[model samples]
Target: MQALQSLADNYNYFITIFLMVSGLYIVIARGNMIKKLIGLAMFQSSVYLLYLSPGKIVGGTAPVLDPAFTVYSNPLPHVLMLTAIVVGVATLALGLALTVRIYEAYGTVNEDQIFARDNKK
Candidate 1:
């Protein structure tokens, strides 16, 4: 029961871990370039969750001159996450564009198929 309660208490970490493993598995298990990109995006999402999950407070307020609020939430992680999201999107887009070019050249997006075709030549 204590373990279960502890697990519930840190469910966010578990979720992040799950996404990370799932993403990694997808990336390794699949041969398609697009699927690998999707997995990379998932892994990036897990990292974002890892940073943002701890930085948020349920009822925390921003730092201000007023004396009423004692707890202030840090805004740095959220800002960083926004930037990371933009960069991740750009990376994904570039990866997809490259995949398109690879398909055009090799007539397939599967890495194994491309390698086989290369070996034939």
Candidate 2:
């Protein structure tokens, strides 16, 4: 149905929002470092979805240098998304590294435990 198609077309953004909220909830409520990483991945995946969905055109062609080709593909969004992916990966790596350090220092990754320990000092 046309209505279903329209829903599908907009579903990516909704899914992205869900992922982001789930990630935030995990980050706030979870006790494990690995779970937090998974949440972070989810958050980033949502962003990737956001970047990818808009760049797609139904009747667009790839931007090639062939003389026989027309319809220039909108490459800006793709390029921006590539950059975003790189930055996201870097941020994830950094976050993971920080988590590792937190684990080493606190012997537990739970936020409450960490806060309690800090308060004792």
Clashing residue pair totals per candidate (backbone < 3 A) = 0, 0
lDDT of each: 0.94, 0.82
Candidate 1 lands at a TM-score of 0.92
Question: Alpha-carbon error at 87 in model 1, in Å?
Answer: 1.5
Per-residue accuracy of model 2 over 1-121 as CA lDDT, tens digit each:
9988987878987888898899888877777777877788788778877877777776767766777766666788888889988988898898889989998999888777899999999
Which runs of model 1 end up more than 4 angstroms from their true locations? 62-68
Q: Candidate 1 residues 1-117, lDDT tens each?
A: 999998999999999999999999999999999999999999999999998988888788875657898787778898899999999999999999999999999999999999999
TM-score of each: 0.92, 0.79
Return the lDDT, model 2, position 30. Answer: 78
Measured with C-alpha atoms, the lDDT of residue 27 in candidate 2 is 73
What local lDDT score does residue 16 receive in model 2, on the 0 to 100 scale? Answer: 81
lDDT of 1 at 24: 95
The candidate maximizing TM-score is 1
